[model samples]
Target: MHKHSYIFITFLSIIGLLVSSCQQQTAQSDEPQQTATPKDSTEQLVLLLSPDQMKTIDLDTTSLKQTTIRKNMLLMGKVSVSPTHLTSLSSVVGGHIKTLHIIPGQRFSKGQVLATIADMQVIQLQQDYLTAKADWTSVKENFERQQTLNAQQATSDKNLQLARAEFQKLNATVHALEQKLRLLHIDPTTLQADNIRQTIQIYAPFSGTVNKVFVNTGQYVTPTDIICELIDPRGFILQLNTFEKNLPGLQNGQKIAAYTNDNPKAKSTATIINRVSSLDDDGAGIIYATLDQPNPTWVTGTYVNADVAVNNYIVNSLPQRSVVSFENKQYVFVKTGESSFQLHAVDIGESSDGRVEIRNPAQLADMPIVQKGAYDLLMAMKNKPEE
Candidate 1:
């Protein structure tokens, strides 16, 4: 009985230890677990307000002032030669080209001999004139004798009158022949000195350079045949063709500035001397403008740009970026009330550099316009409005 009691006490002690360990494990299992909450998802998205939105949200109505507007017209044109300044040279009569005294690009003074003509017709005319002159001299002597005889009653009045009439007729014929020789370009003084043996000489009508030469030695030439083209490079005029729609703004004496890519440093000013009344075959308008300034760098047939200043008028203007094109129409984001933007359609005018003229200024007087980030604002506005 004592051995059994001892073994039972030891088993009771082991059971008590097992029960305390289980109580401690249950307390650990029932303890509250600490879990971290996820961060707010709303903080990850950043709302970016575009320039249009900012203008609508932050525009100050009290500080806005009325803007002065200026209207201008822009036109594109090309440089050309004035038709009035261009000239063509041709022979006055038919003949064989004896010599070419001047070559292309050579300068000549007015009345300078360009070439000589060995014309058989001119030679025959000269011969006839000489013979007529000799006959006229003899006839004048006879007429004087006949008049003297008539006064003395040594010859009949009829014979004396006949001699005098013949003499006068011969004299008139000789004078006519002299004029004809002069028209033929024969120098009367030279002809008289050399007994009319010199070949006819062709002279330039104006002082200019020979731009073209058509005849060589021993070539046949006529009045219709072109001998050369003369141009006075010293007095050059620039011709420009402009659009017809811009014709109303263009007037005589309007100033224009011109330049070329090759000669950017050199600038020339021209005046609108004339405008073409006709339109091109395509129905586009055209105007002819001229510049009197001499430009050696400007060659005929060379194309150049011209800037013509049209009259200026008042207009409302804004930064070019403020305007956006949508569906072939232009619009600007304007402040409607507070922190909100609305798209407003606007008519655009002349634009240059970074500014554009607005046609209707009254519509924008009380509204805030988006000057920066306008395009971004437009893209954002295209989305559904926040509920």
Candidate 2:
């Protein structure tokens, strides 16, 4: 009986051990399981300064503004004269140049005598005209006499016909000579035996500055030979080589300002007259602009710089000093508290006319931005001790 009591006690001890084990398991489950505690990511860079510190830093802040910025498209080009403005004069007849009253770079008036050519052919033409005119009178008198004789039945019809033929032939010869003399710039009615001239004076067709001289005194020339070239400066233009991307912002009649490297302040005004797509290479085209009131000092092939206003837009912006650079990024200080600011990163667009475009303005949340002395805040943030 004592041995049986010992076995029952042992079973009771084992049962008590199982109950404690179950209770411990239940307590372990009931207690909160250990999990990774989430790291704090709510903190940001903030600068806190006293009122005197702000004043000492020369810090200024203002609200974002809608600014109208005028952008310009720059072009490199050269000044040149239009093709229509250049004129070339040639000789009418082949002859030796007698005298040249003009030289290259000299200005001349209209109807001015440019040169004279002495030609034997012109003299022979005049002599033939006088001879034909003199023979015409005798032929006419003989024809009249033959007509009177034919009426009196003293001359045959054949004789009268022969006389009439001679008269018509002589008349035709005289008329032909008159026309030939006129083509030589000689007046037919004004020409007489005593007033015949062997030289023809070439007159200026238009007034302009001589650009090139091809012939000198006593040099023989042909009708196809060019005597000299003239240019009218009033038809000057600016030509630019522009890429295809620039076409969208350009059009005819747009005004542009042009200047040279020698003098930038002396700007020349011009208006776009045409755009040519021919001979386009590498997606480039030619743009032509008429220069307004071109300076007398400027000549063709002058290197010019042109500025065309384009892509005007009204965008949210701030002063250039308002934005600061940090870690190869752009930042602006946003006022979050009376004396505290948060460094806010922003996307920027074009910068011009002392203003910079705020591309991601929505991120600002209508916060006031630190202007004028934002760099000071950057310095302060850099020097601040870690929390």
Candidate 3:
């Protein structure tokens, strides 16, 4: 019995020791863990370059300065042919497209034959013109003879009047046919018996490049069908849409920097002609601007970006090179120490004369910035790691 009691006491002591160890482990795990210290503000975004490295890259630094900058309003615009220079081509009479002499982008002069259309109606028109001409000639001769006879008292007045009436009716018919032939671009004088044409020719009314061709050969079209479009490249206009609040600063002859979205760097100059007073359905106002010099490369309806010179004002500004674009956001490298710079986010406003306006200048108050080699620094800070 004592041997059993001793064994029981030993087992109880072992259980108590195991439970105490487990409780200690659980208490340790439940306690709060300490977090690592965050990186210093300068070290987080700074690039520490050696003296030789800075010289090799030609780094430049400049402080902010208060200067007058011409403010520009950036706007989205579209390229279009001036309303006076646009034209739509279609046949006055419906028929199949018989022949096409030009394609889109081909240049043609005024009065040039563009295409030909064929139909039985066109042929019938020529036949009627010829028949009327022949009948009128015969009747005219008979009437002149009757007039002579009446003057000599050899014919009755009633017979002379009857001949005169018949002659006038034929004359009217001939005149009507002549006008119809003109509308068909056919010369009435050229309507000889053997020279009648079954097809009518359509001529270009003005000189321009073919903008579009809608029909193929042998395709049927009606007078309402838009067969083609033409636009003069010399009359390319920049149509800028802006809010009504921006109207006060716009004026005729104001300068504009315009460029296409496809080639934003190739900027072209334009002059505002007018700011329309009427607002569109979206409450957006339109301003028409003509290119300082027309470009044949500009196509109608191409999206464009433009900057309009609104006015001038004093602001804290810096050289344009001091700012860098990253991930679609503008940033500046601010000098935090002798060899350290932190990437700083900035809100930019108007840019002009190689300078950029800082909208929130207070954020960068009295701090030096990477002026000339900002882009190089941005690349280095983003790619290189700290030692």
lDDT order, best first, reads 3, 2, 1
Best by lDDT: 3
TM-score for candidate 2: 0.56
- Each prediction's number of clashing residue pairs: 6, 0, 0
How much lDDT does candidate 1 score? 0.71
Best by TM-score: 1
Q: What is the TM-score of each candidate against the true structure?
A: 0.60, 0.56, 0.58
Cα displacement (Å) at residue 308, model 3: 2.7
lDDT of 3 by residue, 9-118 (tens): 99999999999999999999999999999867656566787787677676778878988777778888799888678888999788988998989989899999999999
Residue pairs in collision within model 1: 69-314, 69-315, 70-315, 71-313, 80-239, 244-285
Candidate 3 differs from the real structure by a C-alpha RMSD in angstroms, to one decimal, of: 8.4
In model 3, how large is the Cα lDDT of residue 156?
99
Worst 10 residues of 1 by lDDT: 57-66
Q: For candidate 1, give the lDDT of residue 366.
A: 62
1 or 3, which is superior by TM-score?
Answer: 1
Per-model CA lDDT versus the true structure:
0.71, 0.85, 0.86
Q: How far off is residue 103 in model 1, in Å?
A: 4.6
